[model samples]
Target chain A: AQTIHQWPVAEIKAVGSPLSLGCTIKGKSSPNLYWYWQATGGTLQQLFYSITVGQVESVVQLNLSASRPKDDQFILSTEKLLLSHSGFYLCAWSLTHSQNTLYFGAGTRLSVL
Target chain B: GDQVEQSPSALSLHEGTGSALRCNFTTTMRAVQWFQQNSRGSLINLFYLASGTKENGRLKSTFNSKESYSTLHIRDAQLEDSGTYFCAAINTGNYKYVFGAGTRLKVIA
Candidate 1:
C-alpha cells in the first residue's frame, strides 16, 4: 500500500523565523505531489503542485515555496514565517496530474506565535 | 465567484438519520473528488467520480458531467460520520483543482 508521511506533526514558531516542512511518499513511483493549506476555520487552499522532479507550480502566493527534490520527497520551506502562515499544511498525491483520487498525508499543524 | 459551489454550508442531524451533500460546478470539469476531514484534521478520500455513480457501504455518490454537478448520499448516518466534507474538481484544460468551501456535518445522538 502507498503511504505519505509528513514531518514535524506540529510546530510553534516565532514570527520572522525560518520554517521548513517535509513530506515523503512511499510505495509509489513518480506520483503527482501537491501542497495545501487550511486556516483554523478557513477553507482549504492549494499552494503548490508538482508533476515531476525538479518542477513545481505555484497556485497561490503565500510567501512560501515547495520543491520536489526527489521523486518521492517534497519539501515546503520559507525564509521567514508570518502569523498569517499559521495553519494546517497537507501533502497529497495522485496517480496522475488529472487523477481524481488524492491520497493525503497526516499533515503538519503550524502555529506562529 | 466560486467555480465550485457546494450547498448547505453546515448541517445538523440526529443519529440514524441521513442527508445528501451536493456540489455544482460553474464549468465543465473532467473529474470530481470528495473528501471527509475528521476532527483531528486528517482527510479521508470518500469518492472519486469521473462520471456516473459509485457506492460503498452506506455512502453513495454520483457525478453528472452533463449537469455539472455531483451528489453524496449517506444512509443511516452515524456519529463517526460527522465531519467536514469537501468537493474538488479538475476542470478542462487545467491540472490544478478548484475546491468547494466544504460542507460541515454534525451528527448528534
Candidate 2:
C-alpha cells in the first residue's frame, strides 16, 4: 500500500514570513507528484506538478515554488507569505500522467495574517 | 469563463434519501474524477472514469466524455456522507485538471 504524508498539519504565519511545506510518499517509486491549493469555501487549483526528480512544472503563478528533492519527497516553499496565500495545501500522487488516479495526502492548513 | 461548471452548490438531504451531483464541461474532456472533502479538510478520491459508469456501495458515478459531463449519484445517504463534493475534469490534450467549485452536502436525520 502507498501512503502520502504532509508535514505541520496546520500552521499560522505572519505576512512576509518565510514558509516551507513538505510532503513524502512511501511505498511508491517514481510517482508523479502535484501541489494543489484551495481557499476557504473555494475550489482547488493546481499549482505545480513534477514528473521526475529536479523537474517541476508550474501550472499557476502564485509566488510559490516547488521542488522534487528525492524520488518520494516534494517540497513547497516561498520566501515571503501574503494574506492571499493562506489556504489548504494538498499533495497528491499518480501512477502515470495519462488516465491516472490521484491519491491525496491529509493536507496542510495555512493561515497568513 | 470556467471550463467546468457544477450545479446545486448546496444540498440538504434526509438520511436514507438520495440525490445526484453533476459537472458540465465547456470543452472536450479526456477523463473526470470525483472527490469528497471531509470535515477534517482531507480530500478522498471517490472515482476516476475515462468513460462509462462505476458503482461502489451507495455511490455511483458516470463520465460521458462525448457529452462533456459527469455525474455522481449517492443513494441511501448516511450521516457520514455530509461533506463538500468536487468534480475535476482533465482536458483532452494537456491532461491538466479543472475543478468545480464543489457542492456542499449535509445529511440530516
- Maximum-lDDT candidate: 2
lDDT of 1 by residue, A17-74 (tens): 9999999999999998999999986678889999899999999999999999999999
Chain A vs. native, model 1, TM-score? 0.96
- Estimate, for each residue in B1-109, the C-alpha lDDT of model 2 and write its tens digit: 3389998899999999999999999988888999999999989999999999999999999999988899999999999999999999887666367899999999999
Error of 1 at A46 (Å): 0.6
DockQ of candidate 2 (2 decimals): 0.82
**Against the hidden reference, what TM-scores do the models get?**
0.97, 0.97
Question: Model 1, A71: alpha-carbon shift in Å?
Answer: 0.6
Give DockQ for candidates 1 onward, in order: 0.75, 0.82
Write the residue-wise lDDT of candidate 1 on B1-109 in tens digits.
3399998899998989899999999888888999999999999999999999999999999999999999999889899999999999887765677889999999999
Backbone clash total for model 1 is: 0
Where model 1 places Cα greater than 4 Å from the true spot, the runs are none
Model 2: lDDT to the true structure: 0.93
